[model samples]
Target chain A: MTKKERPDNRKLDEIRPMKMKAGVIKRADGSAQVEFGLTKVVAAVYGPRQIHPRHQEDATKSVLRCRYNMLPFSVSDRKRQGYDRRSTELAKVITEALEPALFLEEFPKTAIDVDMEIVQADAGTRAAAINAASLAIADAGIPMRDLVTSVAAGRANKELLLDMTKEEEDAEDAVDVPMAMMPRTGKITLLQMDGIVTPQDTEKIICLAEVGCKKIYEAQKKALLEKYGS
Target chain B: MDKEKTIESKTLSAEPAKIVVPGDILKESMDILPGTGTFRENKNIISKVLGIARTDGRVISVTPLSGVYIPQRRDYIIGEISGINFSNWSVDISGPYEANLPISEVNGYIERDADLSRYYAVGDIIFAKVNDISKTKYITLSMKDPKARKLTGGFITELTPSKVPRLIGKAGSMITLIKERTNSFISVGQNGRVWIKGEDDNVALQAIEMIEKYSHTQGLTDKISDMLDKALGKPKEKE
Candidate 1:
């Protein structure tokens, strides 16, 4: 198939435009807004503060809580209010992805709450949210081994696309993979796949996702330096 | 270069302080020790957050520009009573860690297991100092010092604890200016809470905001002084 046959009419390795800004929310200890093409997500980091439900507090490490939500108007069809099974699972994955990068032991008995709200979703919202959340956590001054950045890669028109968009995601026989990493250490933190693809394609997609995450990493660093004034 | 020469050249000298992000390599030397806001890995001291790198002798640490206040030794802080235990009272120090004020560290000795509620109840604010912090980050408070006591009848506001130094200024100049100009008794906690009392409470609060906004800028003391004069409607004296 020709390049014109690809969804979004772009090259196989071309990613969507990404923009990130840190310290956007006044009330939050740290906050950031991120945009990957048409997908928009805002993440706020609250606390290392008191953990409620008093029983849940951990004396050895800070409990990191992450909430991922999509605004009702975010999708083509309005998303329902409250969380569904998908969002609940996504939240757990995001929290797990961020936990490894933090020095949780330094903040024992505290909870760092990360709230990521997707105000618009085209596709790859989770990846965008991960980038935004990493920025927020850093902005909040929580110690971390490194920032976790992510991107979605998938097969479309028999080619692996760097950052999958809505149209490419809905294509027939698509194999979507969302991958996150601590860019500096090159450590994989989160990886999820949907649909079946050949071993070669899977390897190729993961490699593409790494390259994509590096780009997002630069954007995250740029945003942070801008807010903190270099 | 020999190891000693390299160490001698780097020791007691630091690059001008600049903001750094997570994973940024601060220094690569076994001779230099890593301090707060940094972690050591394979002779490389890497920053763990976005903050300013502060070097003292052979030790390099990072001070966060913004974030929760982590209690350190001998830091004067203000806390609110959250709960009372058998021998200790839990105080919220506005950070992730909760501080415990043991009865022994209170102003005077109180009988153990006696009705402690009468002494200090929940929601009562107190001024104290961090006595000890456990490995698990359990904070302990003490009020045996003369300045440490139960604070009352004042309003509290907060700033980013990192900016507290700016508010206090060099040798307490900024705070002294605020107190004298506003005629308000001000107590600043290292945890970022500020208590102000007097008829000029509004003026103090405004001056504080100005300090916070211009903390990083140069000539802030003069700027705050002009602001206070204008707010107080004082005419400029003819030079």
Candidate 2:
């Protein structure tokens, strides 16, 4: 079918350039920074210790609190920190995404909080945050079921693109699909989509995202090894 | 209706396909589009539909079919106070639940009927220990315990709970590195609250920021210590 294409002229399945670095933050228990083209996010991990208020303690398992935040300058518009509805929602989504991967039961009555800060936004801020947060957790030395890799794929101009850029996302009528997966067990932890696509098209996008997530997962592992050695 | 007819024609012409599993390597050769679904390895049609569930098409997200919950001890965390009682306080610990801290958990003593307000007022940020939990779901906390106490005087940095291990490093090596270098007393709460105190606020602040920067690194202890030595102009050896 004839359709207007993306500026990069990439094929339906091609992903953008991906770069990842771990140990970017010193004070956090674990940290990582990832960039998908222009999209950038930093993730840090803290916790698995004590629950301060005696009442909130869990007798059975540890808790995971996740916060997904975008810097004021991360987007075209400036954003504030703390308790905004968007950040709160993002935090809950991230917490749910990471819950399965973490060994919460290992630290009963405690909680772990993962914070993701988006330094720049092109497209796929949430996906980038998920990928970076997984790396940060590993960097923090938290045991996990596996590393989570995420990517955004979309049907732009009827063509599916892996890792959509800001321009492509803004210019096209596309369905954005973000997914997180465990590199080792090949399990899915989080998946999200927006806009519209035929069931057949959606299936294709998921397949492509999984493939992209694996590639991103490899990059995450490589970065971790490089920073930590072996 | 012409557009509908055209789309129907395209669907018929579209190649018969399958679903992609979690670990499947997606490549151009793969018939699935980047944002589309895939066939399972068993040839079952697996759609990586978006949002919370299959019915929510506008939203795209993947969720576990099912799973179990388990808790571990000694994990770091960040918690918020939800309620305060005469004997204890309640917190939302971000699990399937909330946590509690008894009055005895306060670092200092409270006269039998002393006002609780002087101690841990509502919304106070304290770092305590999770002593134990009853099967009935009672979570016990203690601040008098050496490991649990009031976290005071330090820059508070937040991170993902997953990365806490990397910050502490192998057997607490990472934190030790920062403490020795800056001569700052550091306490890492299980709930993601970190407390650092030192005579020199600048030194303490710098050390905390560095920790935030490198928490995820392996072998970061040495790298950071060396950086601190140079930045602070302190002798490599401790006095």
Candidate 3:
């Protein structure tokens, strides 16, 4: 279960190749698709619009609802295609990660629904979802304070790594540390770890995540600017 | 990966209209006022939306290219009679919230409990003004203005609400040009509803499409004018 080197031959601090595009879905108010190497996710934003069950409306600001789903075929084992405990947890975390970046007060008594569909899973789907969700939110033209970007750093075989794949995630002593942040302020909105790593290594891993997230942030910005033809 | 680039804070103010995304610093001067779609943070005017930044004297604003229409007082809008109540009519103003059109706001008076549908029935188009938007985002529409009335026998199409100003152009020049060329009565709503009342509005519709398509580009007026000329069976005007 131990891997001595990266399966893709990537540097310890290198992230997988990323592809980000905004305004990919026509029906949704805003949509984007992101690919972190083979893992692809499409995120759609559908509000700052009316929220039914008027009782659910927030008086002071807009409410953000996130749904993270993996299609049945997205994984080799075939996901359940239904909301399970794992997807629910991921969706909640993703929502918290993105909420800080938005100016939800701009659209009062409304709901901003973000739906991220994982089309392929090579691990690190949560981070990829956060990256795509922010892009989709920007594309929807909802006002925001900043954009949230995310990535995972982990330790496998005593070596810290950026953007681990399923291979690295399956290794013995693997430590998956996925983080989401508003890069401008360097504020971490999401941080989670699954395996053991030293406090010193955790700090280094976060620094690695910061670098990875910043790169994704730039890509997210470029995609938004391109949509507006800038 | 490319090296992180720091935005030089010393860029000249009022260089030109440029597109910006959220958190982008539109200006870094105290004298510069942050207008709508922008916020001032720690002496820097940062953009709050993803759109084009425009300058008006010392005030800088960002115009969003897309999003739901937010109703404001005095904004001319088009709505539909979706439901009727004893006191007011619920109108769909193509926004996040349905608008209220009080019975008193309508023309003429009718006896209580009378058939309201006899006057302005459901599915009717109303060109009205937003009287007020409550703090809770409840939109109240008024039809008392002389310009406000029930529009009949017209084609309705939607445009990007933010581009309504552009479709109007500087002081109604763009809309005026299209009206004259197509020989149609065009009424544009701030909510992005466009009504065309005329014999042939195909050319006008195409012109609108062209405007929305090239809205972000420069020299748009010229391009629209050229499109109109060719569509109207006239020679393309010399540059």
Show the lowest summed lDDT stretch of 10 residues, model 3 chain A.
Answer: A1-10
Instruction: Report the lDDT of model 1 for residue B169.
Output: 72
Query: Could you report the DockQ of all the candidates, in the order they appear?
Result: 0.77, 0.05, 0.79
Candidate 2 is graded, for docking, as incorrect
User: How accurate is chain B of model 1, given as a TM-score from 0 to 1?
Assistant: 0.80
- lDDT: worst 10-residue window of model 3 chain B: B1-10
**Residue ranges of candidate 2 with Cα displaced over 4 Å:** A1-5, A52-55, A80-83, B1-239
Question: Evaluated with TM-score, which candidate comes out highest?
Answer: 3
Evaluated on chain B only, what are the TM-scores of all the candidate structures, in order? Answer: 0.80, 0.55, 0.89
How well does candidate 2 score on lDDT at residue A68? 86
Question: 1 or 3, which is superior by DockQ?
Answer: 3
- C-alpha RMSD values across all candidates: 5.1, 16.4, 5.8
Q: Single out the weakest 10-residue window by summed lDDT for candidate 1 chain B.
A: B1-10
What is the Å distance of residue B214 in model 1 from its true position? 3.9
The residue pairs that clash in candidate 3, if any, are none
lDDT by residue (tens digit), candidate 2, A1-230: 22444587765566678888877887676788998878899998776545667687776788787888888888887766556887888788878887787666656667777889989998888988988888777666554556678788877766777888878777558788888777656788787888978899899888888888878877876776666344
Fnat, 2 decimals, each candidate: 0.91, 0.03, 0.86
**By TM-score: ranked, best first:** 3, 1, 2
